[model samples]
Target: MHEQLKQQLEHAQAGDRGALARLISVLESGGSDAAILERCLRARHGGGYTVGITGAPGAGKSTLVSALLGEVLAEPGRVALLAVDPSSPLSRGALLGDRVRMQPHAGSPDVFIRSMASRGHLGGLAMATRSARRLLEACGWPLTLIETVGVGQVELDVASATDTVVVVLNPGWGDEVQANKAGLMEVADIFVINKADKAGLDATRRDLEGALASLPPERRPQVLETIATEGKGAAALWQAIRDHRAAITASGELEQRRLAQVRSELKGMMDALLANQVQRLFEGQDAHARVLAVSEGSLDIATASDQMLDLLYDQAAGRV
Candidate 1:
């Protein structure tokens, strides 16, 4: 199985599009490929920046990302896009219609666009996204843009994964309130008031300024306005992104955030694994009987919990 998986990964790394799709499928299914994905992650050398674009629906995040891609590709490096769509609960499939908006770049040799379904994940991110990003980076794609499903609050976790986070919002959309509620005002390295041609642009800018005013001078984010469809102000937005990157790098915050994200992800993985193992250990066992006894008042709840803990400890110590 490992050999077969290795061959698939090798094909993917060699730029076989079908192999790449298969590799993503394998990882998303969550078993043997999980180990393979971990190995691939460990083998990755540093690549281009990963920028996460997030905002509420109708904020023009896709248009903004497409424009930004143009700016990024002007520098002569490969760019990959991971557009995560909301999953349909009824069908358990992606509403991949958003990828249609980016279809023009599908044929660009320097650009690779993939639409990933959120797979019922609450964080507006695909469960397999990190692995997919690693795969793209390993395949020589220097830059990755992760465009998350624009469900406001859920975007925070997705933003934490990227090097620079661009929170895109449009004018008169109650964007300021949403930003504050989502805690986006805090996490955004670069805030973009997209669709600047719309009404209330100045008011939106002022609201953003007011929000920034509360933060310390050193921690305030730079804000830019863009009419993404016409490519207006894209240069300024790109420059702001670069400036944010430079600032974080100079302050050593970039490496610190990376290390912290790695640690958080590792801890989450370990906790999930432990929980799964514990669940399996109790399945079809006397644990259910103990629970029933405790519920029926024949055994105390505390005593039952203690016994379960003891059982877990014994199993960990190889006593069971």
Candidate 2:
């Protein structure tokens, strides 16, 4: 399996889309094979820039992403989009709304669009998103876009994971409380008012501006308006994104952001790995006996847990 994945990685780096898709699938269903692939590709990763788009449901994020694809693809390089969707409770599969909405780019070789199931992961991203983005980077994509599964608030993880985060809102957004309540104001690198042709556009802009007034002038996110369905203002939005990237890169903030993201992702992966180990320990026969002993009052919870930890330590040390 390791050799097979290495071959797949080589082909993917050589522009084989099918191979790349297969590699992404392997990472999505993570295990030893995924770890092996990560080890193989670690040195080659970190070439691409990731931008995240997030907002509340019905904010027209998908439409805006579709419009932005045109602007991104007008350049010479390949671009990848990872559109996160809510997982189906029964099937644990992507809902596919984002993919369906992005059907226009389905046949474009220069554009790679994938819908990922959130798979019960929190903060609007699946565990595989990090791996998939790294894989795309290793395969030489210059730009990657992640459209998060925008639940109401608490989508700030995307902001941490991506280089730039664009938060979308509609015209009546001004009627709501401060954007910070939704946690959008804290994470947004750029604020986009989509569906700007609707009523209350001016009020919403004023509200957004007023809220941003407290922020340092240089740190305030640029506010752009767009009617995504008509493909209006996408160019301006793209240019704003480019400008943000340029500013961050010039100030050396881009490298700092990437380093912090790497540290955060590494910590997350460690926590996940430890959790899996603990889960396996709980599922073991020894754990079953320990549970029975505790239920029968023959053993205390603390002692049983300590015994399990000892067993785990022995296994880790190759003594079990």
Candidate 3:
């Protein structure tokens, strides 16, 4: 690594927010430097607890996150928030509306807030969010909050990336059928009924309860109500978070989940590398010739694919 990068990492570990921001920017940009930085911090990662908040748009997720910060900061240690937002079609940059809503804590030395663009990535999380979380962990932030972009039925990448997944919804969110169809049910560690002051609170709670009835009592996520706009129930929500963490940690589930996450990340990296290699192989002269032959009916696609695989194996074996 470069001298400046090394100095920045050291400064970040010592709690220099500016240096930490620069390091995260480098990771988001991605290259050899980012790879080297990740390698350097590999042993130091995984210190903090990460919480993910996700829900449909207009669910007041940003407001709930801001409200929760008050409860989180009431204690001693610093916390970091990574808010993911939709990308602008023109610039592909974060809209940053979440940052605006969370500006109350922006000036605090102990609060670090970052807004990331999803950039058309599936599952409502930015591609760089995982790396940023690792960087925050290495820097000694005891708690990290990840607020995902507006998600509907299927966006669930946040669950794989965090320790706890909080799924937010409004009082009149939907019927039991819709709740059951949403993939959120599969990953939510806690269900937050934000805007609880609105109508249909009881009905919504019942629907959620019914949808979750299949899970064993010990496995069911608690459904909490909150009026985030008024900061109502924030303290209780934080307490519930703490209780859930304690339970998971004591049962050894926390460590298991983290190990599973590392395994999944490694698999994703391998898939990406393999995809790149496959693309390169397809663009090679021999593969192009095979493609032409197959298209001209002089060779079958199966044989052509076999030949390409043979060529790839030869290249890998240093016999090309």
Per-prediction TM-score:
0.89, 0.88, 0.90
- Looking at candidate 2, the ten consecutive residues that score lowest on lDDT are 118-127
Ranking by lDDT: 2, 3, 1
Q: Tell me how many residue pairs clash in candidate 3.
A: 0
* Deviation in Å, model 1, residue 131 alpha carbon: 2.5
Reference-based lDDT, each prediction: 0.74, 0.81, 0.80
Two-way lDDT contest, 1 vs 3, winner: 3
RMSD of each: 2.8, 3.1, 2.9
Question: Which residue pairs in candidate 2 have backbone atoms (N, alpha carbon, C) closer than 3 angstroms, thus clashing?
Answer: none
Model 1, range 14-79, lDDT digits (tens) per residue? Answer: 778777777766655566556666576552366657888888877888888878878877777778
Question: Better model by lDDT, 1 or 2?
Answer: 2
lDDT for position 161 in model 1: 74
Give per-residue lDDT, candidate 2, residue 99: 73
- Badly placed stretches (over 4 Å) of model 1 are 89-95, 118-127, 175-182, 313-319
lDDT of 2: 0.81
